[model samples]
Target: PAASEGLPRPIAGIGRPVTAQEIAGWDVDVRGDGEGLPPGRGSVKEGEELFVQQCASCHGDFGEGLERWPALIGGRGSLNTDQPRRTVGSFWPYAPPVFDYIRRAMPYATPMSLSNEQAYALTAYVLHLNELLPEDAELDAEKLKSIRMPNRDGFVPEARPDTPDEACMSSCRQGRPVAVTMDSRRFVQPGSGSGFSEPQ
Candidate 1:
């Protein structure tokens, strides 16, 4: 006999299996099309208050980022620069991801204690600081995901062919070899016979 046949129908997933009530856990994803947002709302002002108390020590007052810390605003278009660039407004593509990241990891010392209301408020404040939304904007779960970033269109799917083809290597632009004009002897000592020479 099959092992599952002898078990209870509900436990065995046979006919009319038992079901549990779908507990409405906090799965507030808030997609870009304004989905999964809770009914609550918040503004930048309230976010600033929360930020000053919970944040700012590490993130900076203007979101400029403290010593070796993450900046929360600005840097609209400097991704290609040699220096480090940051800001939720510039680097991040989706607002929902920002909210998700913040909810998952934020306030440095403390993690995941901010209520949903406070998270929405802080999200609004960051958006306001980055000029993505107005300071008085009341960010609810619906509107938060719709906010787009400056570099949204900057990325594209990688279209380059994979390796081992050896077709991607460029031409060696350094033209044909020429006579060495510089004296190698002068560069080194008069009688240095060792294979490798040490830098002065």
Candidate 2:
């Protein structure tokens, strides 16, 4: 059969569609608790090398963040103050999310290009730099999830309406409502009286 005869015509309004494989290639995302982490591992030494070559330009050689690129370490205990400076070693709740974010989008321009092992190494290196992990440690998906953050316990659980017996109106007071007043000057009067000329 001829090619045109064998294949159906494209949809009228549809353009070229993307394949599932293509989408999946760009959809790499690791969740907390290592849900979507790829099978790979990285060591602190490997991460330091990659960081110097790929990250040191924007972020300082020591992960201090060049100019305003954002520091990858330090800022511990800063979140307790009114004006907090958050960093990987400080306010982040989970360590796995950091690896996931880096793997998905990093190196600024070339995002989602690093291998799973490279990502793990970078995560380990950054954690070590921040003093969150030991220097000789290796980071894989499993251990990444297990790494607890200092600020993890600082955040409080979201407060929601409790059961009728436990609920207290005084403890959870809803704000008072405001009344709206219409101003005549805001609208324009129509010359021909056609709905006030839509208020010029």
Candidate 3:
């Protein structure tokens, strides 16, 4: 008899393979173009109610945000200011991701607890708070994708050499590079020849 005949199979039967249903449950991501959005619809009014119940504690009743929490509304036209207030209306370039974020991680204390319809409603209510949607508006995957964000055109392709789109190893600059250096002797103490002085 072969020595291998007495040994157990090489495959370890510790855990079972993941089922398709499990994969579907974990693959709940909505794309920017509205792909993968679950079949559901939610009205702004419904969303308002859901937001008040599930989101108002941290995000405030109108999405202004409580202490230390981020605001979801306003900040429109403030991106160019010294104290820029980045919010959903001022910074987000797409709308579908909003629903995706709310669905996956929201209400802080209990994430992924809300149903798809509830997520949609909360998204609609947030849009309403941003003044992007009417109080009577209803949001589904189709309408959500159609609604353009205020900063839809705000993002541009990165031009830096370190970025993937413009990565380069040599000759990246348009002109001669200038070297910036500080005088090390200036940092030395007057009585100490080589030792550097501590900053006051």
Candidate 4:
């Protein structure tokens, strides 16, 4: 009867259910309160070594970031600057995310290859570079939550609305109607049309 029913109406679900071990490997999200962090220990000293070899290139020797690259340290009193450098020390709200992020994605060319202990050590080292943690400090899942960021209070909830409901189709500015002063096409190659030259 099942064979006559056209392969039993085809299976509703195709693949086997994911096992707990598989879930554990992929669902390693570290929460803000340090929940879901794996059990591992690392010291700042250990971090410095790994960072120099694995992280110093893009992030700079002290997490200062290469030219035009993302910096991980400094910028402590720069949130209000004209051009602020939003490094981990300056903008990140928590430390656990740093550890989780580094473990998940880091070293640019390589990702998700650091051992848990290495990740913890790198986290501590980055904090140390930021002047948040002591050079000799150790960080673990339990200790990571206690760390605070310089700009932790830099951001706050804005209860009030930031935009108006009115739809502005035109004339949104207070100044006199601006005139077209310059044409960008003049600066382009073959400014009259497409950049390609016409055939002879």
Candidate 5:
């Protein structure tokens, strides 16, 4: 008996072409400054209830962050410190993108499972938790896009006009090594996993 073994050829372009509807379905990206937002409405009150059932397990009942999950509400003025808590209220720069992030990935146990209205509600709720939005604020594309982030001006964009690709080839300087601090202040929750971490 002879074994059938030989070099395997690469298979490319074997799948069917994507339809317009399918592409539209998956291309649900919401942009900053209020573009690409779906039509829906959400309120802080609606968000509070949904947050408890769907989000509280990891984010906690108050968005204080469960163990090392991440504190979503506070950290208003700690960005200047060496170790910043870096929550939505403290670090995020825009509002529309907040909706995008939540709608895309949240409730770790289930991502992209929330309806547009639910996503809007959750977005409003997280903002309400941070005290950025009023308790009765109604969130929509226009209003959400207009909300200002606390550290909106905290970032300074890099403009290396003087430095070119050719300059980098000859006189580029290496970056200094960064200091790593392992703080013991962090505690783990009962069922929270460790090792790899995901996007905030």
Candidate 6:
């Protein structure tokens, strides 16, 4: 006899299958290759206005970022430096995701509040701030996908060797393990209650 022969049947009307329309509403993600971008257009000028109104509080007027907030512009050649500034221009490899992120989560206090046009405009404005787009540039799905970020070729494929299929029960290390200590005092601020005083 089948397993279901002795088991209780599934209860009917427990819940309905998810509808296509509901799934469509939640399927708003845009891919790096510009797939799933909604039909909308926005200019850098319009983006600037929207940025000042909605994003300046956290990202700053020029995408310079506020205190404790992230900076969006500059950092063109600092990726290899000791203090790398990972901004939209210096780090991001694609553009469509910019619009995706803004449309899905932004304005800090409010998420998913911007319309498609507004999201495009904001993406254009941020690109302009990073010197990736001209002042009069307008962006739509196609245009956004066509844009090649500065760091588009920065990333490389994973080259590290994969682990063996069989796990090692013991004797994994070939050398003695070295213990490294990190001084947290340098990271603590003078008045942050860490009790570590900075040298004058």
* CA lDDT, every model vs. true structure: 0.75, 0.83, 0.89, 0.86, 0.85, 0.91
TM-score of model 4 vs. true structure: 0.76
Choose the strongest candidate by TM-score: 4
Instruction: Give candidate 4 regions above 4 Å deviation.
Output: 1-15, 158-161, 167-175, 179-200
Give me the runs in candidate 2 sitting further than 4 Å from their true place: 1-24, 157-200
Q: What's the true lDDT of residue 77 in model 1?
A: 66
Point out where model 5 deviates above 4 Å: 1-19, 159-200
Model 2 has an lDDT value of 0.83
Better of 3 and 6 by lDDT: 6
The digit string of per-residue lDDT tens for model 2 on 1-200 reads 67578688677977767898897786687666667777889999999999999999998988899898998877777776787889888888888888988887888899888988899999999999988878899988778888998887777878877655665657354665655597555675535544644656
The total of clashing pairs for model 3 equals 0
Candidate 6 TM-score versus the reference: 0.75
**lDDT, candidate 1, 28-50, per-residue tens:** 45565556556777789999999
What TM-score would candidate 5 get against the native? 0.70
lDDT leaderboard ranking: 6, 3, 4, 5, 2, 1
After superposition, the stretches of candidate 3 with alpha carbons farther than 4 Å from their true spots are 1-18, 162-200
Per-candidate TM equals: 0.66, 0.66, 0.72, 0.76, 0.70, 0.75
Question: For model 5, what is the error of residue 103's alpha carbon versus the real structure, in angstroms, after optimal superposition?
Answer: 1.1
| Model 5, position 114: C-alpha lDDT score | 92
Error of 5 at 134 (Å): 0.7
TM-score of candidate 2 versus the correct structure, residues matched by position: 0.66
> Model 4, 1-200: lDDT tens per residue?
65587555557679789999999989978987788889999999999999999988888888888987788877777778797878888899888999989998987779989999999999999989988889899999888989877777778887688777898777776667878898776777544555447674
